[model samples]
Target: MASMNNATEGQHDPATPLFDAVSHPNSLSKQVTRFFGLGQDRIENILPGTPFQRDVMDCAAKDGQRAVGHVVFEIPQDVDTARLAAAWKETVHQTPALRTCAYTSNTGDVFQVVLRESFVFSWMDWTSLGLKDEVVQDEAAAAVAGPRCNRFVLLDNPDTNERLLIWTFSYALVDTAFQERVLGRVLKAYKDAHDELPRQLETPDSSQATPEEDPNPNPNPNPSRILKIPQVADMERATQFWRKYFSGLDASAFPPLSPPLTIPSPDAQAEHRISYSSPIQRKWSSTTLCRAALAILLSRYTHSPGALFGVVTKQAPMLDQHQLMMDRPTRTVVPIHVSCAPDQSVSDVMGTIDAHDHAMRQFVHAGLRNISSTGDNASAACGFQTVLLVTDSDTKRAATWEILKKTE
Candidate 1:
């Protein structure tokens, strides 16, 4: 590209990282319409990414815990390694997320962009070396400071006639569901190229592997590991806020209630879905009204001033510092500790819930994490017996309920 004429050079700035920029020269760009629940507007060719991606990256940058997921695949024996590598490279060429990386623009904006150059598919074969997969993974994680989707194949096996292909991907790019599609295509390509491979891959360890340096790639191209997240103040503030709200309040602290109507069995405790309605107020969400009614009813039954519960929402509570607008699972179950006196008006309980939800939008995720930093018993103490979830068509929601049983 550098050898191109001046006319081609005029289209892009040579001083800046063209790949991570908001605008790229002579590129095909499209808008990302995936909703992230925070009223984010997805622009053409530029995405801020989702909150979960941002948080994981934030943890990597601050907490030194990079968000890399590795899944191992078993393959049939007698598979041609070269052909498989070629298939994977072809799959990468077709998938944008495989080559996508997040970056921070000079204007203080975060974006996940697909690199303009051809995807450089890298792989490592540990079958002959007789090494554990962990060593291969550690080496790759240490060597790759940038976001990538890498593969390791176990090949040339004759006994079981099976091999392993370990796929390691950065969560910054795509999730598991998308990864499955990419692998499926790669296998299809592998099956199609039984006689001959469409292309040959330079071993990653080869001298001719690394692409020529990008003239002005950003100093820190991988925003996931390099971005400085200065969220200490906000996290600490939220921490103090939750600590105050939960001070001296644990499951053991709550007043003991009457025994279960039906004898609790080792197998099942039973579930009762009692329906009740209250006046729907425009200002308050349906979730809030339902929660208020439940709290008041529980209060009347328990002869106590308040009740505790769980709120299942995709608030992305840590989304305030930046506009985290990409695609990742953002649902979190936050404990709702309502301490309103029964004599207090219904408005009082509703106000507390609204305020808690508001704080949650800021940094309550960090707050709750710190609050539950103690042992599992403390974690269990903070948990609630009842939980609430409110959903809309724009987003999908799923819940998993686990009943921890004790063996006598």
Candidate 2:
């Protein structure tokens, strides 16, 4: 269980004193330090044990105790680290949750790990609940905070030129219910101080939604927009809207070959594929179309329509081959499979989407959840494709079809 490597003295243990000071008694930090035999000198870029850094850690540790949540902000291509650091510091002074914030790095440079104000506490006080006498974290000790989680090191990702930031928050502080609220505020603060929003692969416009009068079905072909929906409200209305749309579709207008249309694997990686062809000539996003198809099937069995997962739409501009390599390699698409009860109803679909998919996206984007490709058959049942829908506006007018086709 020893993690230290004698060949490199400082390289093995990256723990800094400031990190230990901010995180004590919870055993997560202490465990990491003792297990790795970390050294104070291992943290080369930023000095260890700085007051500012301790404050920031304290803030994050506090928030961690609450329900779990996560936020991610892109560092724009032209962002200036010095300016960013100053803005962050200034914001901390003004914000109540961030008043205790300080730098976590040694050299006074902007460290990759950015902590939010509310994420710095212990989750579920045992004594408060009248349970055992154990306290999650005692709020005493100078330069030290209680109820802190174990800290992890950031590894440089050369491919995307970005550092991976990872840590955990309690299910109490940041769960599906409050994920959007916390992350939205955090990202907005970062952007207000920075120049612009971090560039996504595709950006969808809220206004461009087909005007109620517009005859054209597809307003933006390359539609990648994030839609924010509160967890509890409007369950029936949302379900009805999508259900009616799908049910109204003229199934006979499109080519119907069999129960499941199988496509030859386009590339070597795919094992099988499903195809849905429509005849209405109305424009539809490939992603939306596939999701709709799945929704249609789901409705038949469960009597409810499927809804988009959290973050409504998370897309980056369609990156050219070169850009794809240069930018972060975060996988935007995650596979989800749900088995509805035999008598499931629309209420169930709405409830599930709200509680699970939409809410889970926060953790994925925040680096809390690990997202990867799945080759299992279950993903196929849930409609997995390689080529995402391209916007109609971006392509030629032959009723441009931007569909995501899976490779072999």
Candidate 3:
């Protein structure tokens, strides 16, 4: 492969160990660093966490060891580990979701802190322990134990020439859609590094995220998800909309008990990924079907005519790129209350809920704050703890992968 990196003398080498792991830029001028840069580590922004992110972090802290999501991959024997680490670092540098870690101040406000710290790539090899693959996998998960948003772990089985690249992250910030975008960049960067290509790490474009997958578009999703620099009016609109929507409702509308959370067990997560992450066949859309079923079950249990729940939405920019939504918690839990007439058929009820979901979604951006009263909306957050997350179908995902692979 020809070298795509064009650098002059005394410059950072693009090929040999791309990440200068242990140090910052050596007091060089901005011009010099830009010209002969190993991409000096520097954070671009530190912003306040959205209500959704703060709520998740607070709940996750008290909750015992919730499942940390991971992606498994098959890698070739000759894959360069050093270059891979550099690629991972570069990926983090470019992507805000993975680069950020949160902290709650003494006054109890959660802030998202972006760290472009010097990359310290650490690895643990359990091959010598003579452990089984399952044990190794468990160990890999354990490595990313607390408040983990990103960690690249590789497990090796010498006997079978088997290697597993496990990219672990928390469910809090890194939802399913976010994972694919981050993973795409990692793979792209790694491939670029392996082939001695120069990949630009940062480019500033202040415009909001473009719609990558628009089966149906909602108006101004940026404010809805509390994305980049939302206007004061946007938030005020949300407050008024939610306050009015929940006019008669209070925290008492929800049950007293938190739902029983089943802990992670082997193969359960894997099964869930395959089953729910892929599309399922149903008369109504999956989102519609789930909403209908939850309402029915709640009505039965509560001995009421309807049910109140919340749906957590994952914002898109579904593919990897330097776009507006690079930072900020784009995931937010919005209150979804459903009711059906006693005389309505299942199909009719479903249609009603589906249409309602579509119509109200436009209000999502300007309305999350006052859902069940903005102050400590713990009750509202708990009301619909279930995400009801929607993912791309297998066929659509595979086709996109083909296109990305074919791209220059």
Candidate 4:
């Protein structure tokens, strides 16, 4: 089995000239040339998977790969099933990332290989099953969340005239935002084909369009080009910053979760129930408020002046221009160290969180660099004793907290 250390043995720093030339172009001319090349046929490229993807692959190797997101939508009675299927095929034809699959080597290296030949995604009609609405929904979720080798699946409920689309991919390939865009494109393509609209929607050519004119655009037209992971320019400096920031922190700085819970046996299963409401009006943002509360609670529990935790963030801007244009997933979770002095007020902690949040880009870059250097599992908490996940409510009026403990 490949380990983190093994993966780093022969790899060079991603910022090197050779790496940068293939991954990130320094000049507009170079980007233009590469953009055109991506549109060419007979091209086969394997993109190095991001650190986040690498971690997910490692976990999948042990626990089995499952869907990260599953969703279902009601199909209109007027919609034609044949047209919908055609639309889906067209959408997949247009989206290159959808056709790619993760390939892992024995040495722990992972790549997203663009398949030379595309296959139609799986589709099923569950109307004949005579299952209840609730049952169908549950099955849809499970179909995607369950172990499967494919990246995506689509199911249709003809009796209820509803469609359930279930797909799973590594977080490295598509984040929430990327998924939303894809869903939108699929719907638009379906509507256009169904209505037989004469309007022509041209794919945005990065070489021709200016950033301001094409703020939100589809990915590169070519399906075979592999997107590269972004790396920091000064990795050494970023590393020094993290080292200094965490200098005084020890293992006990952030202790384990209180009321220790035992791991379930292999045959045993666990269930979770979650409920959340909008936040009451506060001076701090929802994120700051949550972090402040967490810091205070940790201080009270651990009897320490500070708290350390991992915060998941989508560092989209940190990606290279070509990558940003390609609409790839770049979410990363980084360790955050916050101090709560006895004399400090809640507002003080909020300010601290705000500053830390602003500087998170650097932290993420540094953390990934460290992982690549040490061949450490990027998915591991990387010594973060706790994790804080604050999710937005459906109405976007408030947020909910999901705190997790990292187990070895």
Candidate 5:
């Protein structure tokens, strides 16, 4: 064997070199900073921590999480575009967390605007208002006048195919309490924007022209029935808690998910009676554990795995099939169906669902896109389904979730 020459090697520090450390900001991080328009440094400083955030954190602490919330509205013909824009602008002005025009560069893009976290915050405030109390009054002591409620303006710009609107809360507001307290005000602004124009803004009738009627009629028709879902609790003691709270009223006698309203799938029907103790509970925490336990009970009773049964997440849009759902706000309804393969065990299915929950945790952290933006591919697994939704977090407050079922 030939003798090998020994060379002295230089030692290097373990730390990454400046050139090697330059990594791109993740999609989520970029989105948060860009949509909110906060400097990359301030992204976390002004983020809102409401029921939505609470839900996310709770799920993140564990291995999985699952819950859904939606807002709906009615879009009237001859909608008032100007007022709507003004109203949205007003919401931006009122919100403290987003008082800054954090993402001015991308604000004009509909996709960016729609997914902007600040926009969702504004819409949440809009949806929280009660029918009767449309607008909230400005507290004189706070030195801030109430939000400048205006109509939501939906107009087609030269660039975009979908309609775009400017509502309040386009920017950041510093006060969290003020933000929560003034949600009603933000909604009132949207309502005002929606109602600015008369139901029918008629143009001058043509004196000489006769209009032709088309024989082709609308292929899809609206449903004639209104669905009512009864509020049921998962636990006996919890049911009793609600019963005692509603002392004079009988909670059990509440209406059921009516006919002509079949659930999207048999699995979704089970979700109808399900109750979650911590709406924001993580997938692996006591809440998920409890949910899994209940699923086991359900499996034992129904002779099915958790995969055979799934949860139906509900979404209510501002506009329904034909017109604006006058009963609610204007927004999109998204139902995220969580089910497993038929052959899986209850525990196995639960594990899969838990994985989905964890994915969502990472998803939200990665920044969120509007359900609409997720495209048709996202909802292909489950079409439309009815669910029992809790309008109020108290569990006692519930409503029937009716999806506009159509033969497409």
Candidate 6:
């Protein structure tokens, strides 16, 4: 195993060994720690839990662990197995966030730790499995969704030149945007490796080239600096703010769409889903319009002039310098209060939303924690219910409807 001393200077501990037991055989654990630049003395690097990560951990604890994101792609016929594997290995090596694990302290505090070791990447050839493509895809998705660990699985169908690459992580570890970025990097790495192979084969002295002498190196010189988890002090003010904001709010303010069915069946049932999209004028942001529309709809449905619903927002960049360091789902979903009078125009509602948004941002800037496990539990104890989600993309507006329910 490579010694910790071999790591890049100024990045890791100098005296700490790479492995706790020198007698231990070369194992995945050692490889993980060495690759991640973790000191041997410290088994793991502790990170303060964000509200989003805490909620996800709590849910995964109750429900079986499931992957929060996945993507499938086909590799070109010309891409060799060695090149693909190399590309994947390089991607794993370059992205440290892919090697994290979550755990709850004995005292009930949720946290995430970098797995210094025990990192595993699997490449399976499913061509001989005698399964249909759909079956294989289903199995692949299940495998990705089932694992509690953070890792990547690459499934290849040798005969068909089809590849299924599943990158699964705890919701705390990644979000949709992060998943997209990771997919792009993995594809780019594969292309770079594929493009370099032909050049190597053409070199007259290629055989003389050594692994250590390879000219190409990781493009990111300092991957460790990518993400800085927020410290307790950083979130203390925000936490207090949110705790007080949701206080005294009716827990049953949002009600379910329909009464629960008395009979329960083990068999799966088909679910119906439909989505429609339309463009919005550039003068009005999609979020503002959606918020206003939702306020009106919710107000009429509930027979209330004002409604409170949760809105997911990215964490403030002021909280961390490396805002995009980790692809994890760090977004904070907080309850927002919206009011629409019977005579209020859409424009008026938009203005109200804008003002509310500004105030919310300011509150967050002033150290308002939107959601905490304790705060959420307290709200639920008081009958706080989640009613709806309004999401706005750059060019389109979207909304999802779900039965209102209290947090488990």
The model with the greatest TM-score is 4
The digit string of per-residue lDDT tens for model 1 on 1-408 reads 001111221233322232333233222122211211111111213444443454455545443225565565555445565677777776665664665555434432235654433334444444455435443554355336444333333333454454555555566555644654565677677777878746855445321223323335454333332222324465456556665666655322123323321111233333445554435457887677777877677666666666666666664523333333333444545566666574688888898878777766554344223444333432433444455655433333221011111111
Candidate 5, poorest ten consecutive residues by summed lDDT: 1-10
Tens-digit lDDT string for candidate 6 (1-408): 011002232332211111211222233334434543444333333344554665555555545344353445445455565666565556554665665555454334344554333334456677665434534444344333332345545567768766655444556677656655555565677667655762222111111211122244334434333223444454455556556655654322344333221111223333323243656546666567666776677778888766665565655444344333444544565566666678888788898788767656533422112242335533332222442344534433111011011111
Q: Total clashing residue pairs per candidate? A: 3, 46, 3, 0, 49, 13
**Residue-by-residue lDDT tens digits, candidate 3, 132-172:** 45434543443344443355555566667766555555555
Listed in order, each prediction's TM-score against the native is 0.42, 0.21, 0.56, 0.61, 0.26, 0.60
**Model 3 pairs in collision:** 224-365, 238-366, 238-367
lDDT of 5 by residue, 84-179 (tens): 445544554444233322221112111111111222212213333342222221111111211111122222423323232322321122222333
Question: Model 2 Cα RMSD, Å?
Answer: 23.4
Model 3 stretches astray by more than 4 angstroms: 1-41, 47-52, 60-74, 116-118, 123-149, 153-168, 197-231, 249-284, 300-303, 315-323, 327-329, 343-352, 358-370, 374-408
lDDT (Cα) of model 1: 0.46
What is the lDDT for 252 in model 4? Answer: 29
**Which stretches of candidate 2 lie above 4 Å from their native place?**
1-84, 89-233, 248-408
Residue 403 CA error for candidate 1 (Å)? 38
Which stretches of candidate 4 lie above 4 Å from their native place? Answer: 1-51, 62-76, 93-97, 105-107, 111-119, 122-181, 197-227, 231-234, 250-283, 320-329, 362-381, 395-408
Model 5 residue 253 CA deviation in Å: 27
List, residue by residue over 37-150, the lDDT tens digit for candidate 4: 333232233455555666666555544433344344445556554665556556655676765555554334455554333433455677665434533444344333322222
Error of 3 at 188 (Å): 3.2
Clashing pairs in 1: 49-325, 49-326, 50-326
lDDT (C-alpha, whole model) for all candidates = 0.46, 0.28, 0.46, 0.49, 0.28, 0.46
Question: Which tens-of-lDDT digit does each residue in 1-408 have in candidate 2?
Answer: 000001122322222322332333123323333432332122111111221222233344445343222222324335443333333333332332221112322222112211222122111212232111122222121113222222111223345554222223322122232333333443445557566543211111211211111123233322111111112223233233233323422221011223341221223343335555555564543444554445446445434333211122342222232221111112333334333444776455445544544444433221101121111232122232322331233332221011111111
* Better TM-score candidate (2, 5): 5
